[model samples]
Target: MKKCISFLTVCLLMAKLTTAQIIPSFEFGVKGGMNLSRFSHTATFATENRAGYLGGIYARAGGLGFNFQPELYITSKSVTVNSGSTQNKATFTSIDLPLLLGTKIGAFGVGGRFYTGPLVSFAINKDQNVGDALGNALHLNYKDQNLAWTFGAGLDLKKVSIDFRYEYGLTKQPYNNGNDETRINLFNLTLGYRLFSL
Candidate 1:
């Protein structure tokens, strides 16, 4: 009985050591996707699906089956409204920062990412029916980054990876329409590539 107990203890220790020896593979990649969005309070207006794109470098570090990935990129979002013969549109160009937490099961993977930790925008430009059309050198305010979240799944095929993520905004656009507050909610599908092998 004593010998059996000693053998079991050694086996347990070996398992722990094996787990500790596992290391994560780090890689770089790019991501792009589509955006479908609308104001939360503006139900009278139909939601618009726009072609939003995000392409930038990303670094992933992880061990076992968990990874933390952060990325920087440019994002374009827009909303359109049609009231009979008139058409109205709102477009926003902002730099986006996404921090993703990824998990792997065998060769398949899943992730949850949240963007909006912090950002500085120059507004770049704005086109509104109620305001002036093009003489505006609108600068984006740097008060805070827009809050957003995303969920997606992908496959880590050796050194290459492709992912699809949906992003949703959690704050207003700092502009008000009379008694109505304009908020940002985007549904995005992003595809990314891993550059370096881990």
Candidate 2:
């Protein structure tokens, strides 16, 4: 675990330095938004959209023709179960770092982002004892660390930007039901600003 973290840190620093040397245009920004996520299991189960938050600092380099952007941020995500009007929620927090390859054509810009080389997380809290939500005690088991995948696109304007991305869960939801893996897939749309380097 220590080795992995160290390696990732080195890689990120190298990428930043390399991008600075090769590209001329650079922008730093802050972004925040909601994540609409759904949890799906092999059998029928209930799930709901829980409120989530994401904030990060990003560096955009290179010129109008082609560019590379990378962001480091922390995100909050959760999945809820609702049955017959009763609901239960499980929330997890993670730190994510993503790198994007982007291009421009006319007024519209498009890009593909590769997210999740590593994620560190911990369980903040959960609701299992709420009656009717489960009617009885429910057992949950999960690990604190996970690796996830995110793929998506965005629209870039001169002063503002809008981004859309989808995240997929790769680790099994730590639970005793071996066949059941907590599946969460979310689409994120964010509003951002170019805080530095116009």
Candidate 3:
């Protein structure tokens, strides 16, 4: 494990060197937006989208047409279960980090931006027992970590950016019956601003 970490560190150092030497459009930014999150079921499960919050900070490097962007965010989202006439929701607060590779979509890096990558999330919310609107006890098993695939597009307007992305879960839900799988997916639209440049 230590050897792997050392190797990755060396690779990152090489990338930083290459970026610093070849490209100079480094920027640090902040973003905040809303998310429409829901569960995508494989079987017959009725659920609706839930509104959530997303806010974060990010750093950009390598910008002579292509760049690498990594962001850390505090995100809140939920999934609603349709049980008869009453709706039950499970909300999770997570720390999400996405490492993306992006490139300019237009002329000489002046057009639009496209990015896609893996998102790592750790649920900061703990296990709790709650009652539904009709007073049924709900027991939950909490899982701390999840892996997701994220892809998106953005328009860069100098110091600001407008982005849209989708995140799909690669694992099972934290709380579920063993009979089927419940995966969550979210649509995110964000507006961001570059606070500084390097």
Candidate 4:
């Protein structure tokens, strides 16, 4: 009976150690960034890219090799369009959510990371000033929801992180009474600081 109890205790301890080793560290942080965006298809309208900004919070789970990150942010995007003698500007504000999977390579509080993810955006507001002729001709309307794919690389030094990412639109916005569609692409740079880790 004594031998059986001793063996069981040892087994339990080993299991606990194994479980601890498998779990990864967790981190929470805040981030903000600037972005440049343009419409993919301008058609008759000449489109010019415009600068935008975003600010958000993020959480990361994992260690040295593989990590999962999820983020929530508010972003503003804009573009200027010119058709013949008419010129107009459009701006969109939205809430963005991104779910990313990443791989890290480095040690001793410094690392390089590569990540890819899907992002979903919900539009909070859309503002555009169009000429009467342009509005009637294009039948322009803004979408309430949008989707995209994000690919990026980043560097982490101690508690600070910097990233450069490109977002490709996976969905299209319809216009011209649904006869035409357009997609938007964006490039952004972000800076982040770790708030806490466990």
User: By descending TM-score, how would the candidates be arranged?
Assistant: 4, 3, 1, 2
lDDT for position 29 in model 3: 87
How well does candidate 1 match the true structure in TM-score terms?
0.64
lDDT of 2 by residue, 1-198 (tens): 999999998888767655544456778998877787777554546777777887766777766356677665666787786656667676655555555665543322323333222222323334422231112112212334455566666666766778788777666564323445676667777878888774
Tens-place lDDT per residue, model 1, 1-198, is: 999999998888767544532565667776666666665556555545555555556777767756777766666777775545666676777666567776655422333333223222223344332122111212333344466666666655555556655566655674325444466766656566665654
Candidate 2 lDDT (Cα, 0 to 1): 0.60
The candidate maximizing lDDT is: 4
Model 1 alpha-carbon miss at residue 24, Å: 2.5
Could you tell which candidate, 2 or 3, scores higher by TM-score? 3
Candidate 3 residues 1-198, lDDT tens each?
Answer: 999999998888767645543666788989999999888864456888999998979898875667899887788888787756766677877777788988765432234778899877766643422222102111222244577899999987768789999998886675443455577899999999999987
TM-score of 3: 0.74
Task: State which candidate, 3 or 4, has the greater lDDT.
Answer: 4
Badly placed stretches (over 4 Å) of model 4 are 1-23, 126-144, 174-180
Total clashes, candidate 1?
Answer: 10
What is candidate 4's TM-score against the reference? 0.76
